[model samples]
Target: MSSASSARSGLRGRTVVVPLIPCPRCQATVRYYVSNTEDHEGWVFYRCPNHSATGCDFWFWEMEYVAYLVDAHFLVGNQAVDAVGATEERREELIRASYERRRIATQVATSRAALARPGSLQQNMSKHQESALIGLGAEILVLLKLLLGSVMLLCALCVLLLMKK
Candidate 1:
């Protein structure tokens, strides 16, 4: 079978559940869903399910440390193995990318706010400045209306001449 077909078949028959643990830094329960299996050598990362603005920042291995960490919370009754699951370096890369995106968003917001301040020409025009702009806009609208009316009149005259012929 082709690699794609084999991958599809593998996914169709995989059953794996990785228990989640609370964040050691913030003590919030993290939720995680596995998209791949252990036989495939996949790593599962925990995510805090709290509100986006105030969520805990914790993630750890699903196989070994998760159960022990849960026992330490006193919710679970048993301690498990000490072996830590292999860490995925991609997790740190993803976190760094998220932070960079947030930094850029903050910078954009600050620049826009600075541009919208009172003295900036892009925002908060004086009453006289606003009136002048409104007057110019009205004059342009009147000219457009007259131009359209003239075009319609010329079209009507052309049609009348064609009918007369």
Candidate 2:
């Protein structure tokens, strides 16, 4: 499939779940990879295996892809579709939620880069201290995701209850 056509597909005609999405271009299962490039060190993403040889350019940020599937009712495994409704209003809410997540992730990445720079405040800290701080940041990010997921569940339940009444 052409890149533009696949770009418009958005997980259509395929089963999707976290960490197991198929590449829209080559139909191959994508694997998570850490970016080693100077521009986006430590960032994770999915890349098609055919990208190097066959010129398939299917690449997506890991966190953003998860947010997209979870928010947009695209996650079909584990009975997720029933939990997340596919409606106009729900679609709008999902867009907002996804955007907020991306924004927060960008902020965290910026903050981390600033702290890790040479001669910065973090440079004065011991290696253990710096590692601990990074660990803490990751833990906080997980906690935030849990909180957001819970809130989304509660909202879905409320909508269902109202419909039943």
Candidate 3:
């Protein structure tokens, strides 16, 4: 797919569940990072806290992980759908039809949600595989706090260094 078309496709928009999982190599806390510019904007990944200090190579794309998880779930759902009796060709047709139905249903659901509230940006952050809402508020809050904390920490370090001079 084209880059623009898939910009926020699938699980690309959801916040990565920040696990307090530590880096195996340095035993440092791992953290999530997102690209601010380019096609990778909003794409989240994990890396070691000691990356800057130790040049730690620890990193993972949350997008890839989420895609895998979704694929697994999709497979299971397909199996359930395929349980109904049909010839191989018919089964394939059914799968395609199911996808179309899901797309239509999602659009309908999103429109309904929009009408229910009246006025706001429509957002569907997850799942065959979309619906609607305004935004992922909790995730946004966490991100904002992290940004603010970083700025504060940077200011403190600068002040401390100037004092030592």
Candidate 4:
């Protein structure tokens, strides 16, 4: 048997067994070692056994066969074995979204207040000045009415004197 074939057979009898599926990194046979086994539950991991020589250290959980474990759970604490960086990326996205929401809220509040009423002291002064001008115009109209009434009375007296002549 060739050296590679001999190595394959030697790996079969050991505690670790070669998986039916091939390794993703090396395309060689992936080896599975059952790290924990109880009567009710068991956990296994698959990796390239020739990782030291081939530098192909791809590993995956046995439970991941049903579904990708990292995607199903948001387990952020387990940094050792998480691939794809999904959890970290999700955390960053959430934080950015929160900040964006706050920023939008602030902008909305500012815009609403700006639109609702005059905020500046200068605008308030202008409004007051307009009201004062309207009041002065009203006073001028009252004085003009009194002056016209006096002029009409004086003209009537003059006509009565002229009739006596």
Candidate 5:
């Protein structure tokens, strides 16, 4: 088939129209999300909606299909596949390779920039701060009680002196 069609081959209807390419299997919407790859690239997929009574089993990565189309001389851009000249396998191969190279470069940069693994650091810090605050609060309460006691003692001594006078 044409190069672009070959690239987008496996993608069939999606739950959402993400790649703009209809799923070849069910002619449904295709959904896309951030890829786990270093750069969090966009990845697309297709699945029949539960709304469908039969709920035909259809799912595939829009990623692979796009790669294939690029390999086959089809350019998917601006929500349209240039399916005109994907017949030349060699040219398609070159295009796909070029795209792959760029993808790898982006992944490398993303990996490098992501220095820290996300988790407990913030939570731990919050816990420590909270503990410190609780301790400070308790100290304030203790100081208040001590001050009140001293004031009462001073008042009692003053009354005794006045009685002696």
Candidate 6:
């Protein structure tokens, strides 16, 4: 078999197309390929479209790509795999969730910055300043609590889904 055919020997008619994720090197739609070699048989991975032609060596295991998606806010941590085959409504929901997460993160950063203002500690605190600081602290605590609760809930859901699987 030719090298390309040998490399894709593990793929069959049933292999589904992976969600589109651009190749970092070539700006092309990355292809999902399965490993046929003895050491990594059946392992699904993403790679640049035909390395010999593109001269792009972008490659990553499926799980690694999932993590990259999560970090880039393209997929939520809880829905990374499932989001691959998500429906239009589900994609919209994920987008909204991502937006909400980013909004909360921005709010937290702003509050933290306000609390760490320069010379706020070096000088004596006015009553108003003290109250503002107290308010900011309370807001931070609330945001943190919300974030924790969301994480716990996602964890529980993941456990339940795994059990089902």
Query: How would you encode candidate 6's per-residue C-alpha lDDT over 1-165 as one tens digit per residue?
Result: 123221222222322223556666777777767677644554567777857795787787665655566677766544554534332333355457667767998999997787789656443367668889999999999999999999999999999999999
Looking at model 6, the pairs that clash are: none
Q: Which stretches of candidate 4 lie over 4 Å from their true place?
A: 1-84, 108-130
The Cα local distance difference test for each model comes to 0.51, 0.62, 0.52, 0.53, 0.51, 0.62
For candidate 2, write residues 1-165 as lDDT tens digits: 224222221343443234455676678866666677644554556678788889898776655655555665555556344223322233455457667777999999998988878667555667768899999999999999999999999999999999999
Looking at model 3, the pairs that clash are: none
Cα deviation in Å at residue 68, candidate 6?
Answer: 1.4
Residue lDDT tens for model 1, 1-165: 112111111122342223444555665656653435423233444456563657554544444334445456522332222122222233354457667767998999998888777777443567668889999999999999999999999999999999999
- Deviation of model 6 at 111, angstroms: 68
Off by over 4 Å in 2: 1-17, 71-165
Of the candidates numbered 2 and 3, which has the greater lDDT value? 2
Best first by TM-score, ranked: 4, 6, 2, 5, 1, 3
TM-score of 6: 0.37
Worst 10-residue lDDT window, candidate 2: 1-10
In model 1, which regions exceed 4 Å deviation? 1-31, 34-88, 123-165
Write the residue-wise lDDT of candidate 4 on 61-118 in tens digits.
5444212333444222332133334333434555576677679989999977776676
For every model shown, the clashing-pair count is 0, 0, 0, 0, 10, 0
Task: Give the TM-score (vs. native) of candidate 5.
Answer: 0.32
- The window of 10 residues in a row where model 6 has the poorest summed lDDT is 1-10
Q: Which parts of model 5 are misplaced by more than 4 Å?
A: 1-120
Tell me how candidate 5 scores on lDDT: 0.51
Give the poorly placed runs of model 3, Cα more than 4 Å off.
1-18, 65-165
TM-score of each: 0.31, 0.34, 0.30, 0.40, 0.32, 0.37
All models, RMSD in angstroms: 16.2, 32.5, 32.2, 18.0, 12.6, 30.0
What does candidate 5's lDDT look like per residue over 1-165, in tens digits? 122222233322321112334545566543433344632234334344432655665554454544543554444453334322332333455457668978998899887556344544666678789999999999999999999999999999999999999
